[model samples]
Target chain A: MTAALHALLWIAVTIGLYGAADWLYRKSGHRAFAHPVLLPVVVLIVIFEASNLDSAKYLASTQVFSTFLAAAVVGLAVPLYRSFDALKENRVAVMVAIMGGSVSGVISALIPAWLLHAPEGLIASLLTKSITTPIAVTVAQSVGGIPAVAAAVVIVTGLVAALIGPSVLRLVGVDDPVATGVALGTAGHAIGTAEAVRRSDVMGSVAAFAMIVNGLATAVLLPLIAAVVG
Target chain B: MIKTLAGIGFLVLLLYAVDGIKQALGLPVPSAIVAMLLLTFFFASQRRVPDFVDQGAKALMRVIPLLFIPPLVAILDVRAMVLSHPVVLFLAVTGSTLVGLVVTGLLYKALVRKRGRV
Candidate 1:
């Protein structure tokens, strides 16, 4: 296939997979098994391996979709903007919660890997397990971790959060929307925020605040902690 | 159409501008995040984002999940290596998430309750 056609084909595959997953998710009444993001990743991997397609070429062809990811991250500003008043109202609580959460996220991820005798690279990658992919990947690279491992860990961490977060919050009696949103955003990052948005716009916006605050805290705090430990 | 495009362009430019400043200052934070902070401050001060920008951003939210697939699929190349230490890695990752979530939730809930009682 020509270069343009190849790229178009990959784009088509991506959109098709996403659409199919969405359809399945709705059909399944939003079960995690039919998750749009998770399902596409699994199916795409199977497709690439089954066809024996060149992975690099496949990545190159689908580069456009990734650009949108960056834009989407920036696009999060709108929700944050919309939530400004709620954020201002609960500024002190939100800030304190995010700070505590970010520190706990880093420590929790690292201490386990340390105890389990995970490799140094894995340790570093786990440090970013709670942040969003783009920021986590950058932090991982800066701290001498494997970026891909960090990204995968981030996705898995998010999946866990998306699946377990709400129930866990309920079980723990974290009923306040602000607290619940902050916890989801802090632990789950983008995916958790997406779930929060599904729950309510206010929760979603608060979750966005939590996500950004957590990202910033992690981005700065991880490197500092890495330096101190080293 | 032009206004929407301009709004998007403005947002994208803000993203790059933050990135540029990050590189110049040698800051550790990610560009998108810094851009997000900048936008937050902008909205806090300006009191509103442009109408077109708001529309464009809301549109992006609808498809945000699609953004994750490429990165997740990219994990395919490293599956063998990551899966090699499957037991320790899985437990570590999942355990950390659960711990992180519960700890954060409880902490936030405590603070909220404290403030409420006051």
Candidate 2:
């Protein structure tokens, strides 16, 4: 009975939050920064602030309500599978983009940190900031950086890219799906993929391919960078 | 079916091998990358990923953005923001993004122009 109740609560909270996020997304006219992915987070923050609630308290209160979120990730597969073909056609550019972008992301983060003489712990986390969370944290731990800081930097970077990606694309005069997909995946990863779906099928496929490859590259290359710095 | 189990087993072992590679090289390899490489290798070796695994992979990628939620939320240390300042954060993000975009665009354009649509 307790388990059942817990499950029910998770479901309720997940749905309620997601639904509210969806409404916010629409309300924001589906803008890049106003995406549903970040909207729920914003709502949660506001609610927390207003109520003076701690994160632990919120998690406990909504433990039962967040279960439906598990299924949300499942739906991302549909677009990925559907857009595989474009990935094939633009394979060369996609590879080039990942190679270039991944290298640059590492350098940009590391070089700046070193130049600024920023905290070493922060530098470690920034090393994996370009990669996704699981890997980012792992890399962070390995390099003596705070995983939490790395995660935050990664999200902020991704959000900034996703928010401004379309404008940049337009300014560059790139209308190609392959370019769009590769660029987003290179910079934004998963968040970019979500926005890519709106642009075209080809973009999402490339984004997925890029995201995975970039993650792999960062994992391998970051250690090398660390070795050099040390 | 046995296929799904086998695929998963293959993926795990593959990741383990990647971890082994990192250790051997004295590198700190992220676990997700290890899994990804395993997946890529599987794709290459089989030259054909099974439909179910493909489905699972896609699903995983979909909510990929959400994986960062816990980390982002944890940044609720309001003190950090005051010290960093939103403008500084925005500048750092924006500047890096532009650098990424411009460098990539120029290099890619030159490479593609030379190669003619690869």
Candidate 3:
């Protein structure tokens, strides 16, 4: 096949696989482990390994999707704007909570990896684990980290938050819906917001609000911190 | 359809502008983020999201996860780096997430209690 045809073929395969994965994710009632992003990636990795296809070529073939990802990130302004009123009502409290969560999230990830002496690239990737995937990937690349690793770490962190974040919050006496939502959103990003939505409308809205704010804040903050510290 | 297209076109224009600004100012922030902030500011100033932008944003948001797949799939290449210190990786991700959740929750609660209905 010509290079163009080859790229087209892989792109089709990726979208088809993602379609199937998303169908399964919805059918499974949006379970954290059954996340739409997970299955297709696993399947693609397996296909790549089994066929001995170069992962770089696959990435290149699907570069259009990455562009869309950037567009989607920019599109996030709509939701952020919609959520502004909710955030405005508790401006100071919400801002402080998000800042605290974002800062601690970065510090906690960094200190552990730093103490373990992970490579600089790995440390940078870990820096954005708590943010949503799109922003995390961008921040990671800016800070000299691997975008793929940063995306993976963000997914894992979201999974962890979806699984036990609420329980942990409850154990610590965080029962209010707003607090629960803020905690989950701040720490979990989109995945945590999913779980929070299942709990209550207030939790859901607040979680969504927090998720966006946290992502925006971290995207701007982490890179600056990386520059300052370096 | 035209409205959606216009919205998307406008967003692309904003992205280009943000990129130019980033380059000129040597800002470390991502252009996409700057676009987001600019869009937010625009909507805030207008006190309403235009129909075209809202349509465009919703259309994009619906398939956002699909957009993430290609990059997420690239993880295969970095598996070795990720798995190198599995224990530390696990600790860093999970521990920080939990700590972040609790800290945000507690702080919000404390602040709300102090100020009343915040």
Q: What is candidate 2's lDDT per residue for A96-181, written digit by digit as tens?
A: 86788777766676666666666677667666655656566676776687766766776777776677876787687655666666
Q: Which model is ahead, 1 or 2, in terms of DockQ?
A: 1
In DockQ, how does model 2 score against the reference complex?
Answer: 0.22
How far off is model 3, as Cα RMSD?
Answer: 3.7
Ranking by DockQ: 1, 3, 2
**Pairs clashing in candidate 2?**
A9-A64, A9-A65, A10-A64, A10-A65, A10-A66, A10-A67, A13-A65, A14-A65, A77-B58
Q: Cα RMSD for candidate 2?
A: 5.7
Q: Per-candidate TM vs. native?
A: 0.91, 0.73, 0.81
lDDT at residue A142 of model 1 (Cα atoms) = 80
Q: How close is candidate 1 to the true structure, as a TM-score?
A: 0.91
- In what order do the candidates fall by lDDT, top score first? 3, 1, 2
Error of 1 at A118 (Å): 1.0
Per-candidate interface DockQ score: 0.60, 0.22, 0.58
CA lDDT of every candidate? 0.79, 0.60, 0.80
- Residue pairs with colliding backbones in model 3 are none
Q: What is the lDDT for B38 in model 3?
A: 83
Best by lDDT: 3
Question: Which 10 residues in a row give candidate 2 chain B its minimum summed lDDT?
Answer: B59-68
lDDT of 3 by residue, A100-190 (tens): 9988887898887888898898888888898877678778999898887888898778868877788788899999988998888889986
